[model samples]
Every structure is written in structure tokens, then in C-alpha cells.
Target: MIKEQGEGKSRYMPGLDGLRAISVLAVIAYHMNVSWAPGGLLGVAVFFTLSGYLITDQLVAQWQTAKRIDFAGFWMRRIRRLMPAMFVMLAVVGAWLLLFDPERLASLQGDFVSVSLYFNNWWLIFHQVSYFESFGPPSPLGHLWSIAIEEQFYLIWPILLTVLLRFTKQRGKLMMFILLGAAASTVAMAMIYVPGSDPSRVYYGTDTRAFALLIGAALAVAWPSRSLSAAISDKSRLVFDILGGAGLLAIVWLIWKTNEYDSLLYNGGLALFSVLTAVVTAVLAHPASRVAKAMGCRPLRWIGVRSYSLYLWHFPVIILMNPSGIADDVHAGRALVQIALSLLLAALSWTCIEEPIRRGFRSPFREKIQGWSPFQYRNKRAVSALALMLFLISGYSSLNADRPADPSPAIIDTSSNGQEGTTLPVTDPGIPAVVIPEAPIPMEPQPKSEESSKPATNAGITAIGDSVLLDAAPHLEKLLPGIMIDGKVGRQMYQALDVVDQLKAEGKLGDRIVIELGTNGAFSSKQLRELLSSLQDARKIVLINTRVPRKWQDTVNSTLEEVANEYANTEIMDWYSASKNKQTYFADDGVHLKREGAESYAFLLSKTLQGG
Candidate 1:
């Protein structure tokens, strides 16, 4: 996907670029928060396999012709194709952040250095940055993790292949070696994956992801593109087309049906998908496959040709220019505009930068300008290079300049009656906020009956929740005296049942229950249902939805909305609606409450619980 195969039609496989088009499109769709493609993240895995196949094929071709891999030339070719667009992107994103949002710029230097060095994936992993757990504005360069993986493979695989070929020239044995490596990688991923934790460790690790690349490399070793002949029986061609088409359909299904967080994806599911992509790659490489002909149509080829540039530019455009505040989930019109901007930038980069550098910067106008010599050009470029570098350095330094911290968090008295408050600071550390003003309103769908069985006061009310509830506890107590509140830091939905059961046994289970969990991460609908069932004896239940700015923000709120609709006495208290876009009510980290937010939260819950 990074660069097209230069081999003529019998071997070049534009259908593979067709595959590139599909893969890149899937990734872009995922970034755009399109409803149809939850598994669009799998698109990166597809590109990994495609890259392994193409790069290995190119290397094998060189080996067949020259009897050795040209390590220097191969690496240079890679740099020329990949480096130009990326460096330009870095300079532009850096400058943009410097001028507009400098708070983020302080931390971006690491990302810049990691990307420049092609170790961004490792940087994220080692730094304990969770890819799925992002809360604030995401690093626009975050998607470069895949590029780092591919570049690492490009750097090492050729040398490794040389050693392997030197070890045993037999293709069968070579494939076996590569396949064994792939198996080890798959097993490592499965073994390392913890069911409920952030899967970023395995997701970003080079060793765990090597299986996809190795699968493609094995395919290339077993079926070199150069050796495939145009002469084939019609029956064989039909078989190729049918199998290839089926593989493509299956890939599409997985992209649509699956999600990144599903447990099965880590266990063995991704390996299976990688194998399917390789099969599709294999069929597309065959000379007589009609599937390849159809896939290589003009529109698909055009997109495929610019796929790498598109991939490079899409994420940045979305992060920088998104209209809606939910970060990834944009409205359709805004999504389309952002996508079009991405394409425009990609096309420009491909035409002006990527192609020119890869083709040795040979200008079409070189012939027109008489006496314009390479020597003169080099001298002028050298003189200008210092000034350009210094200008860039000065801008980069300004972006890194220290800024003032906000005034210390507001002093809200979290004390009420004889009960001591949880007195912790309400400011959640390092959680950036991208608040969406249009987040869902509370679902108080007409209750089956007009029964007004609301609690008169906090007499029989019990509030059980996470740190957010803790933040607002003092206000809740002040607003509704004698309301029993139980809250702890980082409490998730699963921990609520035990607390509730303990309270019941202690003769403290209130007839009115207010549950506010799932702020830490997403919980299953089953968990929510079980919690509701346990509180069935309560006269009224108020479900507080979350305002977590992380990826799970929508999931937590939606599941609460969905599950609350099923219960008769349950009603949602839309804290997210009250809090979104009111940044002054929040600490530096957007998710937590300042005094105003806590007071508002307490008042809202009081109103919702008392049937105001």
C-alpha cells in the first residue's frame, strides 16, 4: 500500500492496489466514526498483510534477477516513498499546534521524535499511553503507530530474509520458517491479552503484530508474483475468482460486524482475518483472475495509487478539523467535509511531494530552463536549507515554551452533618476534555402509569457511585439532608453490587437508589441489567449517565439509555447534558468537576430523585 508494484500487468497486480483502496477506505471510515464500520481498525491489519506480500514479492524478484537483496537501495527506496510526506505533515501539524493550542505542544515533541525515528508504537506502549483509553484531544499523529510497525518490518525483514535464504534456498522450508514465526507472534498476542484490560499492550507491540506481516511474507515466499504465468485453464481462473471474491466479502463482513475490543479478536480472530486477506492477495496476483480485473477498475486504481498519502493525511485532518466535540463521532455532513479535505491534502501531497521525491526530483521543466544545472541547484538548496532548518527550530521551540497553570481547584465544602465527606480533589489528572454539547438528553419515556411514588426527601435515598459521585457528594448531602452516599475513586460498575448488598445487610438499603458508575470505562448491558435487577425493590431508581471524555463515553451513556428504557421505575439523570461544553465547571482535565459542576450535579440529581 505504501508504494505500487512496478512489475508489468502480468505481475504488477493493480487488484492489490484495489485491495489497498478498500483497506484505506475502511480505515478512513473508522476515523470518521461512520456507523457502518466498527471494525474498520482491522483495516490496518489488512494493509500489514498487503505490505508484507508486496515488499516480499519485490525482494524475491530482485533475488531472482540479481541473486542478492540490495539492502541499501531497498531502504533508500522506502525512505524516498515514505519520508517526504511525513516530514511535511510533521512540520505543518507542529506549526498549527504552536499557533492555536500550545498546551498540547509541550507533549507533542515525543510524538514528533518517535515518528521521525519510526518507533512511535513502542513509544506509546512504553510510555503507558493507552490507545483505546484516550480522554482528551487525541494526538493527530497517533495513527502513525502502524507506519512505525511497517517501517520496522521493512528495515529488518530484508536482512532477515537474506539470512534465511542463505540458510536454506528451498521455498518450502523458507515458508515454514516464516509461518512458524507468525504462529509464535499469534500465540504471544493471545497469551499477553488480558480479557478486561486495555489491549493496547498487544495492539501496539511489534512482536504481537508480526503475525499479519509474516503471513503475507509466507505467501510471497510460497507463490512469488514473478513466477505466475498468464496461461491458465478457464476452470482454474473461475475457481480463483470465486474464492477471491468470497475472501473479499468475508473481509468486508469482518470490518462491518466486528469491534476492536471484542475478546475473540485478541484470542485467535485477527490471525484468521490475516489469513483470509493473504488468500485474497494470492488470487489477485494470479494472471487470469477476473476478480483482479474488476477490482483494478479505474476509480479503484486511482484511489489505490494515492492510498499511502491518504492514510497519512486522513487522521490529522479529522483531529484538526472535526466540528463535533465527541471527537471521533461527527455528524454526517461534517464527516464528509473532513474526508474531502483529507483527500484534497492527500492528492496534493502525492502529486507535489511523494511522487517527485521518489522519482529522484527530476523536474519536467528541467529541459525548458536552459543553463539550470544540478550543481547550481544543489548550491542554492544548501544555502536555503540552513535558513529553513533554523526557522523550523525556532517555531518548534516556541511550541515547547512553558505556560501558566490554572488557579488551584475551587474549595467546595464536601462536608455534611455527622457524615464525613470523601474530601478528595475533584480534578482528575491528565484527562483532556472534548465535550460534545449535543450528547443525549435523559430518557424519561412516559412511565407505564402516572404513579407519583417519588421519595419526599433523602430519608430513604442511597447514592452509590464512582469518583464523580464522590465529587458531588457534599452538595448532594447539603441539597438533600440525610441522603446516604457511598463513593470511592476509580469504582467501576462491577464493584457496585457488593457495596449495594453490604448496605442492604446493614439495614441501610434505601427505597430510593441513585447509581452513577461506568465513568472509568465501558460496561456491558448485562452488568447494567443486573444492577437494575438488584435495585428492583427500590421505589425509584435514578441512573446517572457518564461524561467521561474517553472512547467509552458514548458507549457508557448509550448502554445506560438502552437499559434504562426496559425498566419501569428506572429513569436516566443526564449529567452529560448538563456538563458538556461548560469548561469552567471542569478542572484542567475535562472529565472532573470544579465547584460549579459538583453543585450543578448535586442539584440535578436531587431534582431527578425527588421528582421535581
Candidate 2:
């Protein structure tokens, strides 16, 4: 997330920062858990390309100057520019968690070291951490995966460039080599990506993502920022603007259109986005481009200048502020506050740490510090005190790496738990039922209540669902005696229709059916509608909403509510709402249940059934 343009042979390009501004904002939008920008995560690929171009341009300039790379000096320069702000952010985060959230602090142990060493991406990969899945108390350093990938590139690309330079003096040759490498990486991503499974592996892998960086490197070789001419004819300028504007528009479109799970993304979609980013970068770096002038406007440039620190601080701000880590609902006012705070902290980090360190640690206000007014003096003191606190936190966090976290007792089924349930009693109101072209299915007798309706006891209640149902199966069984359950892992709503059909065929489908299917992921109304249509003949149907950490949780719940409304025999169990803010009941991932959670969930379902 560091600034693209560094202090080297390259001059400052404000347009490039504007691009960073947009990219980082997109990343923030994705994390904001909003639906509109599902593809906002692609912004990181833009950053990858931008970094590749700038770093390669700088390295090429250095090689042209001395005919040899100064590895130590280059590495030191990178460390100076990037490390201070990161250390400050991590330290501050560590201290906050240490004092108020000891469990989170203890959980951060391995993450702290991996981030410091810039190996967080691989660490997450080795651990198989799911980036898109909801795990409560999410790692504040989770977003640092991209930062780790970029840092790895920054370290290795320079050495590789030096080696490539010795083989050929031609930029064409260099461009060809980088493009080939990018192709190989893209192929690897496609090969590794498993449809309908978590894509975190390919998403976090440097080998798979190298194409984005390589695309930028290739662009720099073909069109170095320094080599572009200041004087350009109007005709060429029009071409630059058209190509640049179109490329930028395409990027924004992708940000709006796609999401992380789209199968094509790993195959070629991401590679295409990177190539477009390089086009925009090329146009912005050109002196003749008006697109660059527009993007370099003051507000955009200002944000661009501090994009790195903004990136570093934003994720932690979002995570810590909403520690429950349920991102399904959009809280606009809260989001605004989070955005404002992130900007404020980013500005502070940029002013106090990044700019000062990179520019040789000289304070611009040294002379004024001696003759400051009361307000200014207080401000300086506050800043200094904050800096001291951050310094102390970093050191303290290091010493307490092995400190034990405070223990938390598991939540008892105090009041009980669960999401969605029991609709009004079904009567003579006619609703179109789904037709099954099969012989009459046999069903065992169901015991009736004194009111002449089927009882809610387990004997006649059939529960069909995914892993969440299995997690709570013991309690469901205990709460309702002889409840028939058919739950499997990784099941979705689309699969439910067939399961329902099979149950009906085998005379296993009960008049009272409780389904908890969407926990694995999302489902369309078409899928839910089809499932509900088949169950229209049932005496009662309970559609349990999910509490998954995935972005699709909202989709699953909303579709259930909407489709359930159309069926007279249906009711939605607001399980997600009941379980909200009750992470103590859940396991670490927040999707599956602990013993307490399962018991509570079962109790809630029992109440819904008795009442229905």
C-alpha cells in the first residue's frame, strides 16, 4: 500500500497517486461489506500493476546510470519508506488489543511476526485462512496480505532485473521476458483455482498474482516514464486521452460488476484488469495526457499522496471498531465515522512518520516549535505524546509475545439462540403446489395435538440442512425427541430441492419440515422458490437464515425472507439476528457452532416449533 512513485530517477506523477487513491478507496469499499462494489477487491491488482511499473522504471533508470545495481542502497531506501508507518500501525493495534482484547492479542502472536518479516501472505496460505470467510476477531493484519505480496516483489524484482539487463540491452527483450512470466503465473492461477471452493489460495499466492506486477514491469520496459516526450502533437494527445479514459472507465466498471468468486477472475479476468491498469498508468505518466491533469486535481492528489498509510490504517480501523466482525448489514453512519477516522489517522501517520522518515527525519516545524502559540504547542505535545505511546507499544508488544490471554467462559444456553421460524397456522387458503410425477408416497402416522393439528415434537418433524444443522443436531435431537435429520457438509439451497424430492420419494418428508441450508453460501430466489414450492403441501416450513461470515450471508437471508413470504405454510427463523453479537456461543470461525451455541440454537428452534 506504499506510494507508487519513490525518490529515484523518476519525477513525481500526481496522476499515478490519483490512481492509487481510487484503488485504495475500492479496497475500502469492498471491506465496507457493501454489495455494489463486490469487485472492489480488484483494486489491489491495480496497485500491483502500478507498483511494478514504478519500481521497474526506477530500477531501469538506476541500471542506465551506473551499469550496476546498488542492492543495499535500494533495499534500505525501500525499508525507510515503507517500514516506519507499518511498525507504528502494528504497534498501536497490538497495544489496543493487549489492553482491551487479550484474546485477540494472543491470537495475533504468529501474525505479528509474519507481518514484520513480510511473509504474511504465505503464512495465511500455509494456515489456509479464508479471506472471504467470516472469522470473528479477524486478524487486523489480514489485509496486509497484499502488502506482503508487494514487498516480496520489491525485494526480488530488482535482483531479477539486474540479471535480465546483463542478457539483453533491448527493452523489447525485457518486455518479452516479463510478459512470458506473467502468462505462466496466470496459467498457474487458473490451474489452482477450484470452482465452488474458497479462492483464497490463488488470491493470496504470489506465484498466481505475479502477472499483475509483471504486466506493470513490462509496461515500464516498453514505455518508461522518463523516456516519454514533453512535446506531443494534438493527435497523439487525443489517442492518449481516449485510451486512458476508456481504460479507467473499464476499471470502474469491473469494480462495480464482478466479485471474488466469479470463476473467470482467476482464469483471465484479473490479468485483463492488470493490463488495463498498465494502460492507464502509461497514459498518466505521459506529459501530453489531459486525463492525467484531471486526475491530478488537488483533492485526488492529496488522497493519493497518503494512500499507503490510508491503506495500512483503514482495515484495522474497520476491524477493531466492529470487533464482532459481522459485515452483512451496512451501517451508513458508522461507516462514515470509520471512514473519517481512517482518513484522520492516515493523515497523521503520513505527516508524523512516513514523510519525515523518508525525508531524513527532519522536522519542518523545528524553528516554529521554539516560538509556538498555546494551541500549536498543545498540538505538538499531543503529537509527541502519541508518538511516545506508539513507540512504547511496539516494544511492549514484543516482550509480551508469549503472554497468555484472559480466559472466557463459554456461553450457556441462558435464553437460547438461532436465526428465522413459525408462521401462522396453515388453513384452507389455497397456494399452488409443485407437482411431482410419481406414484403415491407412503408416510408413517404423525401424532396430532388436542387441536387436531400435527404436533411440533421430533417424531414428525424432519430437519434437513447443511453443516450448521449437524453442529446443532444433538441439541435438536434432545429438544425434540426422534427428530428426523438429513444434514450434510457444504450443502446449498440449490441442492435442497433434490434432497427434498428424495425425502418425499422415500416417505421421509414430514408434514413439519425445518431447513437450514444457506450456511454454506448464497442462493438465488429461483433456488429458494423452487424448494419452497415443493414443500407447499407441508403443514409447516421453517426457513433458517444463515450466520455465515461470507458476503453471501445477506443474499441468503434476504432471499429466504422474500421467498418464504409467498408460501402460506412457510416461516423464516431469524437465526442470524438471534445469533448476532453472540460470538461467545460460536467457534472461532463464527459460522460453525460450539456446544453452547448448538444448544442455544436448538432451544430457539424448539420454541418456534411449539408455538407454530
Candidate 3:
């Protein structure tokens, strides 16, 4: 009698899939910038819980039955289950990049290596990668950072658990202590460090994320046996279901309401929320919970079944369709299109790639115990060779790729001499004395005549933008000879506005404010409006519109034009159009100005300011 394929052991849990659906959907919505999914990133935490619980549950079951765990077999199973589909996805994406987005493709090779090697989190940390930087485009596999985190956890967690079990000699108690300690330590750390820590560090750190997984592990280890399961009455089960559903909703609500500013407290709350979910899931595994049955609804179960594929496909779809810089314009519409496309692609991937491979792994023919075990069947030499080849490909791409020059000033300023109300030349052979201007008279006291012979009191030009603007400063000063140009380089628009206000108060509101910004940054319309509006007193504010790659030019143009129209002092410098007509002005990066371009920009800007 062929043992009924899915008999005795309930390998299918609809609620777990429902939970996965929740996790993946939240992440997708968040990435799409849906107004309601503020905390969608917390979906990774949910996934951690599910992964910990399922893996630990399997391990505990094996341990109980066999009296020892086969670590090699377990890891081999993990590799086969995870790697094949991942490899296929990466290969497809790599090929796509080569055909359509070769420049971005070259940059993505490192990310491909990181994702394939399961080390993307470390790559991000080492590079200090910011999610907001206006690079030409982002990697298709940037979302793999979370996968890297999970894989990294698995590399150490199983060994740690095994060692702890050996020492404690009691699985339940050991997991209990680990769970309690993780939760307490995470909460404590969040309280202490999150207040001042960089938001990215807080978001990505394993220490803070461990508690969610531990909560799931705790449930698996401490699960009540069948005998005790009978003691939980129907009423208690109903209450657990209601409370668990409510808790899930509350967590979603919190995520929707919070932003990066509130992430510290919100993530802490998520830990508590995840723990509640684990408890509910563990208790509701019994056949009696109505809410659990509801979670097992056909649609949710299907979404959960395809969750991994959905997760993998959604981000790339969103990225490919929306592109960088375009997000502000088609953020909502592109998001919907991405979601629909992702679902279609996910369905195809699930039907053709993931399910087939997973099924093949579980096939009885593959499970046959030959003299060689599954671990031995895994060709270590082949795996190593593949890893090396991928690494080489990544290294080749990265070495060949053109990276930006480091912006840190090579020369340090050490001068002590102070000068007041002195105009410094751009071609300063040496660092000049710091000039302190006379006490600021009110703006009302200043004369407005364009030809007034009274010496111009303030700096003639003030350039503000990101690192790229720093390159334009010397030329700007040259064009406005002896005009005391005040350059606030490497600042975001809003931060630069603050500096502008301070300079205005100090009597440095120059006749012309040439903003050579846009490169190295992207801003929302609201943010750009606020920044432009703040420059109310400048006689002329020249917005040096950025010339981005063709893909992003339209977005840059639209945003700049909108902001310029809203402010009376603002006029777009049309750098994009100018650069097209004079290609020598742009650097190879296509964003920063070349030396000639900088000088040309300065010439045109000076003419504009002089009312020529």
C-alpha cells in the first residue's frame, strides 16, 4: 500500500502561508510606496519568525525521532531547495541586464555575486550603501539583501542551537531561555542605541532582528504535546484566534503609520507583535481554530504557496518598470503595473521553476538511500567551482566598472589668520584668510538698484547641491571675480536652505544664487518646493537642472520645471539642454560637470545673474 503521499503528518498549514502572504504583500506595498505600508519592511521580520519556527520544528521532530540530528543532510536539503531556483533567477536577470541595461548590468554584477554567495548584507554595510542615493539606477537584486541576512542567520543559528541543546540537555528549556534573552536584549538595545544610531544600521542589524526569529523558535520548542493539546478547550481556542487576528491587524496598522523616524519604537513593537503571532499560530495549529481555517482560505493559501517567487519577482519588476528618479512621477501607477506584472511572473516562475524543483527534491527516487548520502551526492568541487566562477564574473565587472572619485578633500585647511569682508579669488594659489563680514543690516536697509555703485555687500554666487556641485565652485568663483561666492557643497537641498538662511542673517545674501544641484540627489516635489521657497530674498536663484541619463532626464526636467514655476526668484538653467549641445561639459559619469563644462556653466550663469 503506497503510504498516502501526504498522510499522518500535516505538512500543509494554510495559516503559515497566509502569514507569508501578509509578509510578502507588505514588503511589495512598502517598496511601491503605498501610503498605507509604511512599516512594510517589517515583513522581513515576519519571514524570520516563520523560517525559524519551521526549521526548528523540523529539527526538533527529527531529533525526537532519531535521537540525533543529521546536520549534513539538513544543510544539503537547504542548499538544493534554495540554490537551484535562485541560480535560475539570477541568470535570467543577468542576461536581461546584458541585453537592455548594460551599464546598470555591469554595476549589478557585484550584487549578483553577493546574492549568490549570500553575503549582500555585509556588502551593503561595507559600502555604506544608502537607499536614497541618486545613482544612475539601482540593482535588480538589491532586495536580496534580506535573503542574505536570512542565509547568514542559518549559517550560525543551527550550530548555536545544537551546541546549546547539548549543554542544556533539554530542548524546550534551552529554546525558552534563548527566546527570552533575545527578546529582552533586542528591546534593551533598541531603547539604548536606536535613539542615535543611523536608521539603516538599525534596520539591517542582525542583533535587532534576532528576536522575531527566536519568538518562532520558542514556540516550536515549547509546543504542547497532543495529550496537553486536548486540554485547551474550544472557547480558549476561539479567544486565541480573535486575539491573534487582532494582533496581526494592529502590527499592520503600526507599520502603515510609522516612518523611518519612528522605526526604532515601531520595530520594537513588531518584536512584541511577532511574539504574539507565534503564540497564536502555535496554539491554533489544533484543528479547532476558525480563524486558522479562514487563514487557510484558498486564495491566501495560493499566495502563501507562491510567496517566495512573488517576493523575488516583485522588486525587480517594480525596479525595472519604475526605474530610479521616475518613482516620484509614476510612483502610484508604476507600482500597480509592477504588482500586476510581478504576480504574472511569479505565477509562471512558481509553476515552471520553483514548484517543479521543490517537487523533484521531495521525490522518492531522489530520497533513495544509496551507499552515498545526499550530502555526498552534493558535489563540493562543483559547488566551489561555480562559486569561484561567479565571484570572478563579479570581480571582472566591478574592476571594469567606472566608480566615482572619492570626494573627501585631500588637502586639509590649517590656516589661523582671519580676514573680514574680503573677496577671495577662485584661483587662490593657497588657502586664503577666513573673511568675517560686517554685522548684517536688515534686508530692508539694502538698496535695490541693479547699477548701484555701492560695492556689492554679499557673496555674488551661492552654489548648493550634492558632491557634484563641489566641482562647479572654483569655476563659479572665477566667473564672478571678487564677488565673495559662498558655496555650500555636499548638502541636501533642505539642509542647504538652512545654510542659506544662516548666511543671509550674517549679511552674505549675495546678488546671485547659482544652485548647481540635482546630481547625487533626488527630491520629492514637496521637498524641492520647500527648498526653493526658502530662498525668498536672493535677487536671482539659478536652478542648474541636472542632466541625467536619458532614462531619468524626463523626471528631472518635470520636477525642476514645477519647482521653478512656483517660485518668483527661481529660473531653470537647463543644464540638460546645454550639456546636449556641448557634450564636452559633462564628465563620463554623465552627472558631474567636467572642468570645461563647469567653466561654461559659470559663464552662462554669470551672464544670467548680470541680466545680460
Query: Each prediction's TM-score against the native?
Result: 0.75, 0.73, 0.63
Model 2 per-residue lDDT at 387: 47
lDDT of 3 by residue, 1-612 (tens): 011121112255566777778889988876666666656776877788777777766666666566566777767666755677678778767765675557667656778888899988778656655443433345668778778777776777678777766778776678768877677757754764433123444455566667777787777777622222435677887787777678667667767775443434534766776776676566445456666678778677777777887888777666655433123223455466567656755655555455446566464433422112222224434543443344334434432343334321111111101112233111111234233223222122233466355554434555555434555657655555445444332344444556677877987666667665444344456656766677676688888777754322454566779878988888987767767867566644455567887787767777777778
lDDT of 1 by residue, 1-612 (tens): 333334211245778888989999999888776768878989999999988988888887777777788888889888888998999888877886777666667768899999999999999888766677554457889999999999999999999998988888888999999999999999999999865446788999999999999999999988888788779998899899999999999999999987766768899788889999999999988878899989888778778878898898788777766422124555576567667666766655666577667667676522222111222333444533543343344334432342225534422211111123344322222333222212112211122244335443556888887657767877776677668877755566766777888888989788999998766666667777888999888899999998765556777888899999999999999989988788777664456687899999999998898799
TM-score, predicted candidate 2 vs. hidden true structure: 0.73
Worst 10 residues of 3 by lDDT: 410-419
How well does candidate 2 score on lDDT at residue 102? 72
Q: Flag the better candidate by TM-score, 2 or 3.
A: 2
RMSD of each: 9.0, 10.4, 11.5
User: Over the stretch 527-587, how does candidate 2's per-residue lDDT look in tens digits?
Assistant: 6777788888889899888887668677667778888888988998888999989977775
* Alpha-carbon lDDT, every model: 0.75, 0.76, 0.59
Worst 10 contiguous positions by lDDT, candidate 1? 410-419
Which lDDT value does model 3 have at 24? 91
Regions more than 4 Å wrong, model 2:
1-8, 323-329, 366-378, 383-464, 471-484, 488-515, 522-550, 555-612
Alpha-carbon runs more than 4 Å astray in model 1:
1-10, 323-326, 362-464, 479-515, 524-544, 547-551, 557-612
